[model samples]
Target: MSGQVRNTTKIVFIGAGSAAFGVSFFQDLFATDELAGSTLTLVDTDPAALDRMAGLARVLNAATDRNLVIEHTTDRRAALDGAGFVINSVAIDRNRLWQLDFEIPKKHGVRHTLGENGGPGGLFFTLRTLPLIFDFARDVAELCPDALFINFSNPESRIVLALAKHTDVKVLGLCHGIFLARWFVCQILGRAEAEVEVAGAGLNHFQWLTHVREAATGRDLYPELRTREKAHDPAFTPLTRRLFHSFGLWPTCSDDHMGEYLPYGWEGGEHGFDFAGDDKNREYLKTLIDDVASGAKPVPDDWLKPSWGERAVAVIGGVLHNRHRYIESGIVCNRGAIPNLPPDLAVEVPLLVDAGGVHPVSLGPLPDAIAKLLHVQASVQQLAVEAAVHASKEIALQALLIDPVITSTDAAVALLDELWEINRPFIRPCV
Candidate 1:
């Protein structure tokens, strides 16, 4: 495998309205020499968003002096044709509907730490989004059968697993959970961006770093991280401080965001962000829409810069340059990838990706407790995918019930009912 273009690759971004992510990914794609001749298709329902993304792509292409051919479309099928890779990043207008996901759950006396993942909100999101994903998958099967599908949406592992079990499309899920793991280690060690050694493996947003050591001394940093939280700044929450003390494990996500997923983190006045705070999420969405509609704001410097999303770039680079790079990706259905989990399940693990193709490394079985927790979440994801494929409201309800954040059966049922009612217009009925 040498750095040579064996074939022209077509990469499609499913939701180009997500300019922040699109810009980041496109910049990374443009930076790599292997991706220079690839065709990038930006697909979005919103014409304005697609236009904005086109502007960004042009700026990036000019800056990098890359010959990456850029295309934009609102039709999924048109954008998907002959694509070698597809990346999904769509969200169902959270500002307008996410409040319904949160409010209805709270009405039933169910609390969620974050509405986006691991709760009723996430379930509803899955319900709404999975149908679209399956629609894309079906099209990919028919039109781009040999292409690799990469999901960048939330509940990534579940989504990928659902697709793998239900469709023939080659799929992988990806997230920045590892970046958060690095941030957690840095916070614990009180170091200002020191080089460190770390190893993490597990489901998205739930992976734990089993090893954290100083790069210089090879000294284990976990023990010191365990003890020092007590003396650290009071800005950190007690739930987080205690989690570090008890689990002897620092979580990949922050306390404010992580609290919603775990039961004990938010019980009895525990310090955490309110689950109903859709203010920021809504504001960001509004800003994006407004900027696109009015063209009144200046693009941020960050938007003009490049990013390091490794998967797409690595694949393109490998295919183009024949440079084999190891990337941690959530690939579906490798028998030995994770020892204890069902071989059919999609597992997030490190894989050696190069010009030849993607390969998953077997991390062996996860610890029993972690595997148990992941199994629960994975079940919800699987069920959600099934619901989308079959259009079964019952399966969607079951997925919500299986969710760890929704403890009470009655609450789960109620939230499910509300979501069904709210999302009835968007969801295709299960046959």
Candidate 2:
């Protein structure tokens, strides 16, 4: 399939309005000729936001002479009938609910660094988001079973686990976490960015960096990382450095995320994460979407910075061209990819994407100690998914107990009651 062009490829964007994600997803499509002429169907429940992104798609494509076929809808079932790839990046009042996700956990005396990915807050966020995810997966099963379901939703690993384990729909989660691994390598080595290669396997937000080498020389960089971490400043990445010192392997994420899974995650408390600031940025993006579309705010002349494009477009392009590209990390069901993690768990590992579809690069086996640490949380994630799939409050309570932050059954009960009461309208139980 090398150099092949699927001119009529249909790629659907679900939750494009609730902002599961939207059309700049196609910046890569516009840049690559092979997929430039493909069809894009945008599905979002919000007509206003959907229309705004559709308008921006026209603005972007019009700048490129409009080679792609673009359409928008509030109906996902209608759009799913023929899409070759269904990318899900849905957010429902993400900023507001996310603020709740962070605050309510704090109120229950559970401090988490990043509430969206781990800890009790992660479980709550999963409960709110997974129902919508199940809806999309169920619809895909009925309408486009052959379509590859690529998710960019939060609690990424858990959502993938739920869909992969419960539904027969093919699914994977994509995140920029690996790029963070690459960036940290460059920072520690004092080298140019993207000049290093690193790999590890574990649940998303909890991956360990197994090795680091020079992209050009293939020289192992682990020794240097260890030396630096041994004397690293507590102010820089205390939790991450502490993990490296204790685990004998470099972890791939910052304390902001890695801390989420650790008991001492709230060590720095208000000093560590900036959820409020992050919500402000999300608000800016929301406002900018409308502003950019209406010409009230100009799209940055340099907005198309080279990122992994959230990995969806890159994987699609790689498969279309049979490029056999090595994506440093992708979230997929274990399926023996790590040989140690449960096959139903979502593990972030290196992958090869090409004509045959995406394939996980086996990490052989993670160190027993690292596996031990992750399995604790993997158990929590597995139960969380089951809770969401069955909408079983009993399972949900069990997941909360498995969370490292829930020190007492009393705290778990208080947190669950508070969260359920607050999120009642948003959470829809499938059972």
Candidate 3:
């Protein structure tokens, strides 16, 4: 379990072309000494994009002197054979489709905060994403049955729930939202991030911080956190601040993400996602990758360092070498992890990862009022998955109607039809 130990496990990266994921992922791989001799297969539908990342990976491999066996392919099935780990972060036509996911719902009079993880946006995301996810699960089940499937897709709770409900793949969904929670606490408590410990359990975008303490002293910091929060600037994280007061448990993530699950989420803002900004960032990263890979620019020192915040590679190392470390957060099936929530629901909670695999840490029960709110989302997410799996128009409509963000049945019908038309080509009946 020492950092000096090396393993030759075959690790497959599906959707390796993603500029956002590829850079941090490769950095993490290069930084892990135990995985130095491992086989890394990069798979993507776009050959050119895959080649670019493969080039970047090779550059990092040589620079770090890790001796990793690097491979790339557009065909995922070819890369799946005998793989011990599969990391997936695929998005279908990301920005263009996401723009519609935001605009079309607003056009129907559905007021939402963020269109990616909850509200009408979340329903459409589940619809557009699940068909492909099911296909990936089927492939993993057949080709590499024992490989740990690490998912980094959005609509995290819904995706994890769908995969857990329908597939036999050993799956785990990882997100950086918990770090957002830790950051918020550190900013408020005037403590460094490493000095504060925070844990939460709920749906992905809507987790509540049930445990917040000073890491050094094991002292509860929530009492002081509440005191400082009341006098703090009202404009900063206003919606989350309000929710913490109302629910008596601080909501994790930020205003936009936390706002997704509430009807009054528009109080945060309705400006929607900045796709242009994202596009610009992606292009810049692509250029940087090409420069490093083609030797036009030197391999950046950051590329040789570990990922900024991602935990997937750390989980892979833990499972590979039996390092029983506590992972801050992971998306997993509830299964009584939270006593009040449905066992089938996917809840974000602290995890214990080691050779036995990822285990969800029980935080007992949340407050009754908070549980009521999450229960509604749990039902909505369940219906959303069912709608996607069957491609059932009726079920999809039911999901929209029951959602708190949708006020009008007529609008729900209109939004569903319009969004469905856009995503129809990608959605297929798993049953």
Candidate 4:
């Protein structure tokens, strides 16, 4: 492995203040000798968070026995110069802003179990962040023309699509959706640890596994999963239990988080589902900010754990060793990835990743039932990206009205108006 190493690559992480993900990705990057002399730049607007991450990077670099050049910057453009790969992990102010994302929708009669994935909340977030992402894309075009942009931000597919449609930068969206799906498979199999083969493709947060098989044998795993659900295991999380009961299909994401993405989960008044009054998003953001600001070690339980974010590591490994590994990733453009969807829409699918770059596999067309749901969410993502690039409130409103959670035109309009007013300071002006 050491002798198979190739040229070092410059990896720049935007929003390095995000401790949980930043630390995990950095550690994963440092683990391989292939990246021994690589340049690692951490960029963030928050000085306190940057400083803490810088310190953590130093310790990890030394511990890994790698001569990695770790640097920190408050300015994103400065950090991106001459980089080969750029990872975006940014979020708006954690607690206060996220609370608004979750709470304001409730006032407008829109319910969202997960505030950040897909809903009025997710749409508003994309509206505010897309402009900033495109700004970075423009800079990358000028400074790092050949860089591979990996976006880990919320509204993942929308952001990637914005870059693909509006900019020339080579971009791929990264999320832990597949990893969560694997976790569910593991739980359902009743094995402490089991290797399962799964394939899924769709827009972010809406991805569905088409097949689940046991790696050791050629046997299908879906039947076993269905049986486990029938037995009613209390160990299954609330969301999974509810999904099995209602949808007759187990979901890949947690119950609370999956609610915002699916039309049935939050809308159907069954299994005691409550989208409003869920403070987990707020608490998670607060915990993250405090963790990074106070130099808090090992993120709190309230925050998302980063153990499952393996794309960065996988990317680096593939590049360094010229080894191909298949992982499901959210990327812009259909291009035969999902046969049933439009060729231009962004879809998250399994890809063959290597030094050559990511190539998404075609899952053919999704079942019409799933495609309809995906189409609704994908439209919102497309419109939000358009709104950001053009700075058009009308496009943003279009995105809101098309969102699954907002049922009526009046409800959609009211929610859009409130979001527009509340987020005015953050939204970029329409040109």
Question: TM-score: which candidate is best?
Answer: 3
C-alpha lDDT values of all predictions? 0.69, 0.78, 0.90, 0.72
Please give, for residues 1-431, the per-residue lDDT of candidate 4 as tens digits.
56764578788999988866775686566666767788989999989778877776776666567898989999888888899889888877644666677777777777667577677777878878877787788889899998888888877877877777767888888887777877777776875434777777777766777777888886888888878766756655666566556544455556656667766556432223233443565346446555644556553332233245467767656755677877656566777778777777888888777878777877778777777767777777777777776778788778777777777788778777877787777788422
Q: By the lDDT metric, which is better: model 3 or model 4?
A: 3
In model 2, which runs have C-alpha deviations exceeding 4 angstroms?
Answer: 1-6, 18-24, 268-275, 286-299, 429-431
Write the residue-wise lDDT of candidate 2 on 335-417 in tens digits. Answer: 89998878778999889998888899997899999998888989989888787767777888999898886777887888788
Error of 3 at 261 (Å): 0.8
lDDT of 2: 0.78
lDDT at 84, model 3: 94
Error of 2 at 159 (Å): 0.7
Q: Which window of 10 residues has the lowest lDDT sum in candidate 1?
A: 267-276
Q: Show the lowest summed lDDT stretch of 10 residues, model 2.
A: 300-309
* Candidate 1 per-residue lDDT over residues 1-431, each given as its tens digit: 58643456889999887855675686577656666677989999999778877766766676577878989899999988899888888877755676677677878988666566667776777677777787888899999998888788765665776777767888877776666667656775777545776665655666656677887999997777767766777665556556555555565556645565566545523222343455566457556645643556654545444564446666556644556776755445646677766676666677777666677866666677667756666666666667766668788777777667767988888778777888887787422
Deviation in angstroms for 316 in model 3?
0.6
TM per candidate comes to: 0.85, 0.92, 0.97, 0.86
Clashes of 3: 0
| Model 4 root-mean-square deviation | 4.4
